[model samples]
Target: MSLVVSPSKVFRVAEVILEGGIAFAPTDTIYGLLANALDRRAVERLFAIRRPSGRPFLLLIPQEDWIEELGLIIGPRQRKLLSLGITLVIPKRTSVPLYLTRGRKSLAVRLPSSTAGFIRDLLKVVGVPLVAPSANPEGLKPATSVKEGMAYFGRRVNIYVDAGKIVGKPSTIVRLIGYRSVRLVREGNVPFREVLRFLSS
Candidate 1:
């Protein structure tokens, strides 16, 4: 069992992930089971951990520069939402693997203002988007700490980065209905009025 002090400390974490190992780590929202979004087997392992695949995850991207690479386009409104740290469900790029979006027409992507330094650096090191679902198994609450994550995953994960207790809920999820319309799929850490205000600004 590798208990990492921070995501950056562990050279082995990225190595293991490059080799298709899943990790339990804290995110901007909660502890998440992380795997390379481009790795089919690793993603399948994440689905297996969820036992029937209940909660789909948003992809953690390091920056906006990756927009074209993923086959996604962001307009002014999306740029605003990104500034507010809201997750946007946008049209998938044709190059995106089906496993990443579960064959859905859209997928969630966010820069995650809540990540630790380690998570940020790890994203840079991995050089690929990562799928981070809440660390608990299906039907369980999202784990906010390492202890809770461990209870759910035990030794099933390759690395565990304990960031103590993380605050706040998940990011607000918005689905773009068209060029002019947006839908609130989930009201989470960010408030609805704030989202409206941001979009309007």
Candidate 2:
């Protein structure tokens, strides 16, 4: 049976995720299915549940330094865009696992926004980055509430961290082309124009 937790019980949520358990919880952008990114078995379990169609899931890091650790070069522009809650797609270091990158040359990664205090605390307590894909099967809308999450994942997921209804859209995804510009991968909650303006400034 899966456990349902309130936003206040983050320590318990951390425990489950650290044990290679999958948790459906609220992210900075939308509700996501989270597991330890470093654990291959845990990541496989997340894939089993998500059943992504050859697309890789995004990783959420607690700090900017982790960008380099994950084999991506982080520059001033990358730092600025990430701080504004943008997801970055950059060339993957050969060391990144095939499961995480899905054999792609690049991987998408995000740092939780300061506003997502619950998720930030959860990552801090878990002490590692998490593979966070939106809470839904492929081709379906992401769950905004725990009940909707339950409907999609049922007891397959280990923990459900409810933060009420999360109506927020997914994070804006982008790829940096040069020092001066970025390519929009997907338009989500963040405006592409705003990202361009931030880079241009």
**For this target, which candidate reaches the highest TM-score against the unseen true structure?**
2
The alpha-carbon RMSD values of the candidates against the true structure, listed in the order shown, are 2.2, 1.3
Q: How well does candidate 1 score on lDDT at residue 197?
A: 80
lDDT of 1 by residue, 47-164 (tens): 8876565345688887777666788766766666776677888877677777776777778887767344667777878888888877778787888887787788877787888777
Candidate 2's TM-score: 0.95
Could you estimate the TM-score for every candidate? 0.88, 0.95
- Per-residue lDDT of 1-201 in model 2, one digit per residue for the tens? 999989899999999998989999988888999999999999998898897576788999988888878887556765688788789887767887798898898888888888888888888888788999989999899899999999999999999998898898788999876554679999997899998898877
CA lDDT scores, all candidates in order: 0.76, 0.87
User: How much is 80 displaced in model 2, in angstroms?
Assistant: 1.7
Clashing pairs in 1: none
Instruction: Tell me the RMSD of model 2 versus the true structure.
Output: 1.3
